[model samples]
Target: MSHSIEITPIDDQCPLLHQTKKDNIEEAGKINGQYTNKSANHIIDEKLKDLDKYTSKKFIAIFKVNVGLRKSNPDAYTPMLISIGPYHKKNPQLGSMEKYKLMYLRRFLQRKRGLDVEHCITEIEKLKGIALKCYDDIENLDNDIVDKFSEILLLDGCFVVEFIRECSGMKPNREDKIISTNCMINLVLRDLLLLENQLPFFVLTKLQYMTKEVDEVPITKLVKETFFSILPKMAHASYLEREGDVKCIKHLLQLVHMSSHPSYYNSLWHVQDLSLKIISKDQDYQTWHANMPNVTELCEAGVRFSKVGNTYSDLEDRTTLFDIKFENGRMRMPCFEVDDVTETLLRNLIAYEQQTCDVLPKHFSDFAVFMDYLID
Candidate 1:
């Protein structure tokens, strides 16, 4: 006799599964290095010294951002978390995020052998100032891609694109923040915001100090050229942005994801400088795409968009992203597939961030309880 039985799937809505709404801030925080490690600072300083032999100011932002993320009271929706990359633990069961967080936090806040601890006060001060400023800018932070793009533009010749590809891939917590290829992408972009301009100097100092950190030839040479260059362009880019030249603004914003070498960066730059020159008007990509069938690769990074109450004016010329573009009088968009850990965290952060931005007085009792439990 043969028997057939049906296998029942777990319901996401089941309370036993806790559903996604049960905010796990404490758990996430615990993984994000919320615990105290007494000897943490000394080890961090040593790590910083070792890294400095390879690069200067490299660990500054690494530490600054690392500490910023660490020091941030999780109550603020400013919960943009960062830590070691997915590759850190080949096996999750054997590897512990707790140890990783301890080291990561220590590295950011300590000063060891390589540092002229007495004379290094000024350099540390500079990092603190910039980091504090960024925190202040949080309220004014534009969620639109253009601001990010424009910020990149203020740097030299697609250098950010080059630098990011080289440095990124960190996560604070091991257990829940799911690692993916996209995480790598965000890692590069976010870190670039901190270390982009300083990359070239960082490279030279790093190479002289630690010869075997990585082995990429052309990338090394290119970094040398960019670090030495890029200063003059910042002035011109600043001028264009202040004028609200939509084309120039959008073009620069797109550059965050591009570089002088990348085709996308080249394509986007061409569209911004020469394309408008040819069109003889402040025409956006919407007007250009109507006549041109192909989308330039560069424009992908900077995009024109409208959300709730804001307009990314710099991204005006990017035209609607093809996904959001219309075809044959119909519209299409990627399915918002839920049920992933990162996606869930992103949604949670987005919702919390939105609430904070929208109201001065926001509730955090539940969030606090959740976060406290995780850290405790």
Candidate 2:
């Protein structure tokens, strides 16, 4: 004999089933009430906590390059020889230079008879609040960050101050390894200009004042003499001389950026307006997809290319490296010597403009995009 089992389905009014449903509903209600009981301001505060960290007035200019921009050329944004600031302080490749930094720090403290490492540390520690705010990613630091950060500011600040001094002809030691050879000096300069490898200008300035080194010379003058000697001129001589307000400069990279900015504001505006005309009103200016005709195409269509010559003759009447113009079927552009140094500098400048798009005009990026169109 075969037996078959009969199944009974759950009924709508089953007491156990009703109790389970009621329990789930009550638990969900409790969870919902926890949120609903919050005041509107409390809800908003919770929502805006992350935004507040970034948008606060205390936040300053230094920022990490966005990953999308950085991934294209990782080496372009990284320091090769020496690390500066807290961003790359722990980079293993940069570890070899820490000894040299310490040596420089020793030399820095010796500049004044009464100056000592303890005093320097104490003074820098005082500026900790201001210095810390100048960089991004401070929240991700470890528990002992206060001590670590203060130490970095001291060493890096001393290294920069001394390095600039040595470069400015202040009688560097004959055996100094960093500036001992031309290759090393160039590498150090390249490393210093990387956006991530920078301390706030104020930290260096304060260190200088504390030691009373180069008291007569402004830090800007020392920087110009040191940095400009190695970097090829990307702007007119007058533009290089037109220093940004020293008080406003954030770091070495920014100072160089400001010095190289094109002086032809009217031309920049005209170019920007021309770009605006090409895009539909609904499209974003940044996302406008139009590209100018390449050089070959323009040449095929009866355009002439000429290099702007004799720019150094009269600095007062010179156009900047970025001042490209087209008129009467002739295209004139400032000549640029393309090489390793130039590429490195341009790449970093473009990266800076890309990362700081909100606060800064895209002068470098626009110049690069124009170049891209011309080249290909």
List model 1 lDDT by residue over 206-253, tens digit each: 222222224434333333232212111122222222222222211111
Writing each residue's lDDT as its tens digit, candidate 2 over 1-376 gives 9999976675643443234575365455455563334355576888788775553444566777778877878888888889888888778988988888998888887777888888887898888888888877776766575468888899988999888888877744464544578887888899898877889998988987776644448777788777765554454464447474677878888887777656565445334443333333465556644644677877897878898744342334455666676666788777645556677778887777666645355677777777776787
TM-score against native, each model:
0.23, 0.79
How far in Å is the alpha carbon of 165 misplaced in model 2?
1.1
TM-score of 2: 0.79
All candidates' lDDT scores?
A: 0.29, 0.72
Which residues of candidate 2, in runs, are more than 4 Å off?
1-58, 172-178, 213-215, 239-244, 263-291, 310-319, 357-360
Alpha-carbon RMSD, candidate 1: 22.7
Q: State the displacement of the C-alpha of residue 124, model 2, in Å, after optimal TM-score superposition.
A: 0.4
- Whole-model lDDT, candidate 1? 0.29
